[model samples]
Target: MAASHPLLAVRGLQAGYGRAQVLFDIGFEVHPGQVVTLLGRNGMGRSTTIKCLFGMLPVLGGHVEVRGRPVNGHASHRIAREGLSLVPEGRQIFTDLSVEENLVATARRPRTDDGRAPWTLERVYALWPRLKERRHNLGWQLSGGEQQMLAIGRALMTNPTLLVLDEATEGLAPVIRDEIWRTLATLKQEGLAQIVIDKNVKRLLPLADRHYVLEKGRVVWQGDSAALHAQPAIVQQYLGV
Candidate 1:
């Protein structure tokens, strides 16, 4: 199928910390109901790109657009309210809060025109049944996989149109990682657009619609899954796995 208008677009994005520039002319797009993976080894501006998108870092240059609306200079909260949600690298959850509370804390009613009701505690529980079993457990009490699920659930509570997951399956057991991947596949079936950062190319290849390979603060390659499969050398060279 032909790609549609991007739900999120990054054009000529440049960002840095203090005097050091990290990203150079970074650009990519994530269409509705599509999953886009940003692939790179450590310190190649992957996280920096995400920070710029969420306004967590100052943008030295470039523009970030959501649904074609400019959000380059907007506050992080404002950016999120505009239907973009980020699940940061670490499974950042409220340790003192109960499972249900954490999910409800970020819950937002869906817009009237959204055509679907906002996600409920029950729906989230269904996605991760362990959360339902530990509905009253604190964030710290949950295992890594459970915490990851809670983080994703919290983001879903916001009823975002686009979900950005930084290191989605970074540090989990093999089985847990499989569960996470299965959940992502389910979300894909439900038509959620996502920007995912992960190193598991084998799993990512099947889940993501497109891939962007970054090297030293720039996108070196961009293409669909089939194209990526045809270029294993490119993956071996840049990914180093």
Candidate 2:
């Protein structure tokens, strides 16, 4: 079980690619077992924020702490070892590797001190049985949905403390999208902390505990589902209807 503090916290985060800054004063929190969403249209700073959080980009200012340990400017591999796992915007799976190999590549023992069980191939297969059926297929051979599932399973194999998804659902059939949402709900029930970025408000609203809406690389609004539901104007103004 998580302590009484946030699992991941970012305050006044600033980062970019060298001279061109894309994020400004970005901030958010994801407590243990909490589901948080970063919402915005394309070209916003959502993906940039994820990169900075995962140490893919350098932090220009502010603080980023995971479980009270400051990880600002840490190396990406170091950050991963510290328990932040990212499913990047593109499903960057190893195209040549088979499903089982991809999952086993990053597998690790859960670093949790609590009695929670660590994720294993058997558990991942249980979550997405389709992956088990396609265990021998190369990454490029799977459909978009199967690839997404593999990406997610590979992350779980890392036994991360916080799961950050850049684009939770972008391109997929309706059935696949629904399965992804259900998988997310199951992860939430299993006490996994998650930070999701996706455009499906109706689906996200119910699943997320809180939301941060960004525009022009800054967080414009932050609130819970009920608060967001109470203000449609904010959604239409910052995010499209």
Candidate 3:
């Protein structure tokens, strides 16, 4: 892929379940080494958009491009092979699998041309050492925080060029949330592009390179951290903060 090209580009995306339309011409782009956030109040189509991106839900219309390749109607696994990985909502780890099993379940090597250090079990463990300690524990045996860490490590094990995280720090202890944020910061330093969704706008402001605020399934506002930080009312109005 060209260095100047976006890692992922979503343009005029339209998707929903069966007969219930949710997203309305949604659009966003994530570039190499950038952290872009999807901010919205609950049920405003944030998670729905993520599902569409990962090919978990078919798009009703429009397109999603990964590494500049159109993947609108591709299967989820096929999308994963195209250098995108997701830490989906609810940290859906395999209940019967051990922590090591979960990490290696969907692991993959990077493309030769990817030109980045491929993520290995060791690297992921280094990022989240608690996972190393619980390597033999089953997914269900871990606490929520530990499960979330495993979810992230599993995604990293895929060696994705772009990682998408839904609700990056929801339903966690404050300390755990801080740990997650710090890991994200470390990933940022390592130049891993990410698409993140979370309620912690305060934590995201410094971590994110750009912000897209959604409402009624539409992008109501978008700007960089400085702009978003300057406009507190935007958060109050759109995010109900």
Candidate 4:
């Protein structure tokens, strides 16, 4: 089980590609078992935030804490070992690896006080039956949705305390998107904290307990789902296409 405090906390985070800053003092918190959505239109630094958290991009300022431990300066692999998992924007699975291989490649047994083990291959296959059917298929052989499922399953294999997903449902079919959302909901019930970045504001509203809106690399708005729904104009001003 996750600890009683926030699983992930990012404060005044500043990061970007060399000589090209993309995030400016961005901040958010994902409490234990809570689902938080990072909302914004394209080119709004949402992906940059994920990259910084995962150590893919260098941090120009601020701190990233996992379970109250500062991780902003850690190496990417070290961060992973510290219990942060990321399903990156492009579903970047190893194209040469098979479904089962992909899952096994990232599998790690987490030590929790509950004594319940982390995800097993059997459990992951059960959670995503389509993946079981495609167990032998290479990553390049699967469709977009299948690849997305594989990405998620691979992350779950890490048994992370915090899961960060960039573009969780971008360019997938409706059915596949629904599957991803349902899977996330189930993870929530299982007490997996997540930070989701996606464009489906309406759908994400219900899935996420709170919403953070980013604009030009800054968090311009933060509120609960109810507040967001009540102020569609805020969406229009900052997020409307």
Candidate 5:
């Protein structure tokens, strides 16, 4: 079901590294069960917006809310505890831990109110049987695709209220990327909220409920996929399509 209120909201969000500002007064939102895409070319502040959302960097200004509560300056761990899980740019699985260990390391009980079955180890393995076969393998032992699966499974194990992926399918084989996209579709069907950042506009447009295009640290365009589809010129101009 669509949320009456946004599950995640950012308003006039501003952030930077030292003296170099990356995000301006940018804003966007993700309601429950909605798949929203953060669209932009490299260095247009898409990642920076995500960093601010998860409290990886300090919020210079603006309101950052999760589940209708202000969380502007909270720590990353604090943000995670509030039910926001992020699959970062790199597949940052713990290199030393085994796949099974990694999945359980940050696991949290699923929320019962959502009317969805909580993700479990068995369920994750079912989603990707390769993971079940390699359960005892160290994180560093998995291929890039397997590692990406592990990263995602780890987040799912945490049972987040909102799952955010930065560069969701970057640098993976086409087959693996298809699997990832398929899994995302399944999650969306199950009513899990997500915000994905990927460069494939053709694929993303159909998967996402809404889209936000960023240009030079500002949100230049925002609309539903159909609206964006109607304006190919906009995609080509800002996204270099």
Candidate 6:
């Protein structure tokens, strides 16, 4: 069972781009070592929530907390220091940097109080040997799959407590998608908490401990796998499953 206290919490979160409001009273919690997902169609404010959590967007109302500490208005770097790291929607890699440079660019040892082992450059290369093979290649030289792997490796180098992946497998080949899923499963087994957003509901159902389904920027449903399985109607209604 997971701990009672949440590792990351977002309550009444509201945000938007410019004068357009996209989120309404959005809320959720990610417990230690647990895997959760934000489920919704495009333009449903899923990415907006992620942006607010990382302080990339201003919060209209609400708060985000990490390990019981408030960090809603904090900068992205501050959020990373609080143990959150993100693999954004697109595999946005530094086009000019080599694979090794990308991995080390944002790498940092965890806070002394963090009990997990540090994620070193060597560790990331070991996790994806293709990265090691392409270590000297510029990001733009990599194939789509290789760039995705590099993106994930870069995030891992942050030594995060909770990893947030937005459209983690977007635009990847089926084989590469399988590889990404396998990596996430391995990370879960290693007890790294995660918040994932993906369109592949079938793939997510088995992996996520809990799910929050968003509709028009509100949480229409929140439940575990079993509960989700029991309510196929809700899945069809909001998720178009």
Could you say which candidate leads in TM-score?
5
lDDT of each: 0.89, 0.89, 0.91, 0.88, 0.91, 0.91
TM-score of each: 0.96, 0.96, 0.96, 0.95, 0.97, 0.96
> Which regions of candidate 3 fall more than 4 Å away from where they truly are?
1-3, 113-115
Candidate 1 lDDT, tens digit per residue, 129-185? Answer: 999999999999999889999999999988888889999688788898898899889
Q: What tens-digit string does per-residue lDDT give for candidate 4 at 105-130? A: 97887846433357889989999999
In angstroms, give how far residue 84 of model 2 lies from its true place.
1.4
Question: Which is the winner by TM-score between candidate 4 and candidate 6?
Answer: 6
Model 1 stretches with alpha carbons more than 4 Å out: 1-4
Off by over 4 Å in 5: none
Candidate 5 residue-wise lDDT at 201: 89
Question: What is the clash count of model 5?
Answer: 0
TM-score of 5: 0.97
Off by over 4 Å in 6: 112-115
TM-score of 3: 0.96
Kindly list the per-residue Cα lDDT of model 2 for residues 173-192, writing each as its tens digit.
89998999999998888888
Task: Return the clash pairs for model 6, or none.
Answer: none
Residue 101, model 2: Cα distance from true site in angstroms: 0.3
Give the worst 10-residue stretch by lDDT in candidate 5: 110-119
